[model samples]
Target: MKSSIRRRVLLLALLPATLLALSLGYFFTLSRITDLDQALRARGLAIARHLAPACEYGVISGNNQILQRLADSALAEPDVVSVYIMDRGGNVLASNSLKQSKLAGIQPGDIPVSSQNDTVTVATRSNVLFFRMPIRQTEVQVDDFALTSTPAPAIQPVNAAPLGYVAIELSRKATMERQNEVLRSAALLTIAALIATALLALRLGREITVPIMKLASAVDKIGRGYLDVRVKLGGNDDEFRILEDGINGMVSKLHRAHDNLQEQILQATAKLSYQASHDMLTGLINRREFEVRLERALFSAQHQDREHALCYMDLDQFKIVNDSCGHVAGDELLRQLTLHLQQEVRERDTLARLGGDEFGLLLENCPQDKALELAEIMRKTVEDFRFSMGEKNFMVGVSIGIVMINHESDNVVSLLTSADAACYAAKDHGRNRVHLYQMQDSELAKRRGEMQWVNRIQLAIAENRLQLYFQQIQPLQKQEQGLHVELLLRMIDESGQCILPMAFIPAAERYHLMPMLDRWVMENSFKLCDAYIAPDSCELQTWAVNVSGASLCDAGFVQYLKSHLVDNPALARTLCIEITETAAITNLGAANTFIKELKSLGCRFALDDFGSGLSSLNYLKNLNVDYLKIDGAFIKDMADDAIDLAMVEAINKIGHQMGLLTIAEFVDSERVLLKLKEIGVDFVQGNWIHKPENAEALCKT
Candidate 1:
C-alpha cells in the first residue's frame, strides 16, 4: 500500500518515542523491584546475626524461654516472616510461629560456623528470604587466685564451641506490592508519553503535509493549463517558503507566456490573409504585390482609358537614424510613417513598402495633377513627423517621384525604373520635394551609372576579383617593430583594370553592402597573416584592416568576427582593426564595447583618419585604441601649409601624450617626412615610403 506523507511522518516520529518510553519504564520498574528485594534480604540477614548472639547463652543453658524471647523480638520487626532457634543436633528449640517455617529445616552445618567471627548465610524460598547463622559458647576461666610476688601466669583465650544456630525468614509480599506499584506508575507514565508523542507527531505531519498537498493541487491545476494557479503557503521563511516562492514565480512566467501566446495567435490570425502580400514590419503591401498591381494597372492603361500614378517615396534621414540609433528605431520610424502616409492617401490607393526607407503608392483613375498633390501631401506629412528613440529625436523628410500610368507606359520594369530615376532627381534637387519623371533627367544618368557600379561591385565579389593590398608603415625611430602594414581593399573590373575603393565604396555604402566587404577583408587578412607569419612571429608583425562605419554599426558583424577569431585564435594578436574617427565618435558606446571584446582576445584597435572629426580629441579619451593614423588631408599639405603643419604637430603630440603610436599618411616627400619625424610621429606611410604591394603574392612568397 502506498503510504501518505502524514502516515510516514507519524510512524517515523512516534515509533522511537514509544520504544524509548517503554524501555525506560521497564528498566525503572525492574530497578525498583530489585531494590525492594535487596532491602528485604538485608533486613533478614541483620535479624539472623542479632538472634544468633542473643540465643548463645540460652542454647548453652538449655533455657527455651530465653530462646523464645529472642525469637519473638526478631519476629516483631517488619517483614520478618519467621524466626527459629535450634540446637547443634538440628532440633528446633524456639519458634515465633506455630506453623513450621522453611528455616526450621536449615541445618547448623548449612552455615559455616566461625568462633572468631560471626557467620551469616542467606537463601530464598518462594515469596520468602532466609538468613541463617551459627551460635557459639564462650569458655569459663578456672585459675583466679595467683601469687602477686611470683610472675603472673597469663590466661590465653581459646576458640569457642558451637552451641546452636539461628535462622530468619522474611516475607516478600510488601516488596512485591511495591514493585507492582512502581510498574503501574511507570506503565502509566509511558502511556501518557506515547499519547503526547502521537499528538505532536500528528501536528508535525499536518505541518509538513499541508504545504505538500497545496503544492500538489497547484501543480495539478497548472498542468491543466490554469496558469493563474499559485501555491501560497503560510509559514516562516524556511525551505517551504522558498519552495512556495519558486512555484509562484514559475506560474507567473507561465501566465505571462500564455498571454503572449494569445496575443501572437491573434496577430497571426489577422495576418493570415495578407501576410503573403504585405510587409511584416510596416503592415503595408509588399514590393511583390505592388509590382503585381502595377503590372495589372499598366495592362489596363494600354488597353482602356483608365489612368494610374505610381509614387516612389524615399526617406532622406532614415539612414542617419538607422546607423546612429540602430535598426530597432529605424523599424519603428517606418511603421509610424506608414500610418501617417496612409492617412494622406485615398482609400482606393495602394501603399506598399518597397524596401529600406522606400515606399510605393499606386493611385488608380488619378490624373498627373492629382497624383502630384497627393505625393506632396505625403511628403509634407513625413517632413513634419518626428521620430523619437531614447533621449534622441529625429526629423525626417521624403523625396517622392510620381509617374503617370497611361497608354505610353511600356512595362512594369521600365515604369519602376523611370519612377526611381525621378526619385533620385528629387533627392538631388534637395529632399522633401516631389518630382515628375522626364526622359532627359540628368540625375537619371548619374543614378544609372551608380547602379552599374553596384552591379560591377557585386560581380567582382562573386567572381573573386576583389584584391587585398598592403601599404607599408615605416617607423622613423628605427625600432625593431618588424613589418607594420595597413591592409587595403581593391576591386578588378571585367576589362582587367584595377578600381580603387573611391570608385565603388560610395555605392556599396549606399546599398548597405559594407558588411559583406568588411567580412571579406577580415577573413582574407587573417588568412594572409596566418600563412605569412609563423605562429611564433605574430608579435613581430602588425597588420591593420579598415572597417567601414556601416560595418561597425551592423549588428551581426561583431559576432561574425568573433566566430572567425575562434577558428584562428593565433591570428588575433597579429591583426589590428582600424575604424575612422567619424565612425567611432558617432557610435562611441558600441565602438568601445567592440574594442574591449576583441582586445580581450589579444586583438588591437587603431583610429583611422584621425583629427577629422569635430570632437576628435574629446572622444579619443573614450575610445580604447593602440594607434592613431593622422588624417591624410592634414598630412598631404602639412609640408607647405603652416596651419596644416600645426594641426599635424598637435595631433601627434596628443596621440603620444595618451600613450598611442601616431602614423602620418600621404608622406609623399622627405620634407613632409622630416617634419613628421621632428614632430615625433611614430610611423609614416605613403607612396614616398613604400608603394602598395599585392598582399596575396607577398604572403605566398
Candidate 2:
C-alpha cells in the first residue's frame, strides 16, 4: 500500500513537471518569433519610408544616377531582398540590380500603396514580404519643370504622380527559418534537461531504496530464525539516517526478544524434562529415566568392548528415619545424603533414584575393584554426612551392591536385577555395607553367562556366526495340529560352541547389548525363514525373536529391522518381534512408537514375560501386541503352586479378552503342559516338550 502511494506520487510529480517544461518552451519560442516578426516589420517600414522619397525625387527628374544611388542605399538593409523604382506608366526606372528584368511583368501599380500616412504597403509573395511606400509631396520636393522648361514654375513632375513606389521585398522565409532553428535548439535543451533530471531521480531513488532493501532483507532473515543478521549502514544523511536509526532500534529489540525467547524455551524444556525424569523429593533421576540412561551407557560400553560397573544403593533403616524424624525430615535427610553422594562420586558416574529410598549409580569405564572403591567412598559419604531439619541433626547410611559388567551380560535389566540382588545380599550381611557381584554364586553365574552370551550374540551378528535354532511348539490337544516353531538365536563362539541366549541373555541385557543382539536375531531369523523354511509344510509358521528393553526403546533399530526385511521381503510377514511388558513399560514413549512403526511395515510384536512387570495392563493396551508370553516363573510352578496356577489362568483369561494369543514358557513337565492346555494357553515351550535345538533338528520333527 505504501509503495503504491509512492509510485502515484512519483508519477504526479514527474508528469506535470515534464509537460509544464515542454509547454513553457513552446510558448517562449512562439513569443520570441512574434517579437522578431514585429521588429523586422518595423525595420522594413522605416527602410521603405527612407527609400520612397529618394525614388520619387530621383526618378521624376529622369536622374538615373540619383535613382540608382538611392536604390543601392535602400538595398543595404539586412532584411531587404531587393529595391525597385518605376514610372507612372509602369516602366521600370531604377533598381538595385539587373535582376529587375526578372520582374518584367510587374509594373509600379502591382504593389499596393499604403493607406496610412507614414506606413509602407506590405505585400507577401511566397515567404517574402514586399514593403511599398508612396513618396508624398511633403517627403519628396521635385522641380516644377524639367531642365528644358527653364521657368521651373512650381511645375508638377510630368508623367509622374507619385513618381514610382519604393518597394522593399523582405524574405519571411529567413525570419521563420531562424525562429525554427531557435525552437529546435530549445527542444534539444529540454530533452537533455529531462534526461539529466531522470538520471538524478534514479540515483536518488537508489540511494534511498538500496539501504532500505538491505534492511528489509535483514529483518526477513531475522524473522526466519537467523538472529545473527546485521545490516551495514550506508553513507546517507537524509531519511536514510532516520531509517538507519529506526532499523538499529528494531534490531536491538529483536535481538533482545530472540534471546529472551530462546532462554524461555530452554528453561521450560529443561523444567519439563526434569519433571518427567527426576524424583521430586531427592532431585535424582527416577527409575524409568535411570533405566534408560543405564541402558544407553551399557550399550556404549558393550559396543566399545569396554568394562563398566553398576552399583545399586538402598538406605538402611530408612523407614526408621521416617519413623523417628517424620517423613519430612526423612525427605530432607535423603536430600542431604544425595548431595553427599554427588560430592563423593566422580563426574563420569551417574547417580539415580530407583524409587523409594533406593538409588543406583552407573560407573562407566571402571573395573570391579575401582567400582568397589567408589562404592566404599559413597557408603562412607552417606554414613558421615550430617542431615539437619530445622536445627535438628540426624545421620543416615546406605547399603551398596556392585555389579561389574563384561561382554557376557544379557541386558540392562539383568545387570540391574543382579546389582539389586547383590544390594539385598549386602543388607542381609549387615546394614551400611557394600557387596560386589561374584560370578561364583549360582544366580550370579547364570546372570554372568547371560551377559557373556550377549557379547557372543553381538559377535555372531558381526561375524555372521548367529544361526537360527527353531523349536517345535506342539499342540497338546491334537497331535496333527502341525508344528509351530519358536525361533531361537544360537551364537557360535570362538570355540565353536552353540551358545544359547539363556546362557548370555541376562548378561547381554546387563551390559546393554540387547538391542544389537535382538537385531542380529531378527536379521538371521528372517534370513533363515526366507532361505530354508518350506512354505507348504505347516504353512512355515511365523518365527518370533525376543526383543529386549533397549531394542524396544531404540528408534533406529526399527529402521534396521525394516532394512533387513527389505533385503528379504519374503520373510517380513513370517517374522515376529517379542518384547516383555517390562521392556515396553520402561520407555513407553519410545517403545510404543517403535512398535507402531514396525507394525506398519507388516512386522508383528508380542508381549513376552507379560505378567512380570508392574504395568502389564497398561502395556497391553498401549503396545497392541499380538501375543502374550506367560512368565516362566508362573508356568514352571503352575502344577504345584496354586498361586502360579491362578496367575497363569488370569493371564490366559486376560490375553483372550484382549484378543491376544497366550504362550507359556518353561512348561517343563507333562502335568504343566496339561495344566497350560486346560488354562487355554495358545502355545507352550519347555524341556518336557522339546528344548531349543538346532534348526536341522527341529526340521526333522
- Which of the numbered candidates is closest to the native, going by highest lDDT? 1
10 residues in a row with least lDDT, candidate 1 = 110-119
Mind giving the per-residue lDDT tens digits that candidate 2 earns over 103-181? 4447765655445554467765667677777654443245655587555345333333565666667767778988888
TM-score for every candidate vs. truth? Answer: 0.53, 0.42
Stretches > 4 Å off in candidate 2: 1-37, 45-82, 86-92, 97-333, 339-397, 401-432, 436-465, 473-481, 494-497, 509-701
Clashes of each: 0, 25
lDDT of 2 at 576: 74
**Could you tell me the TM-score of candidate 1?**
0.53
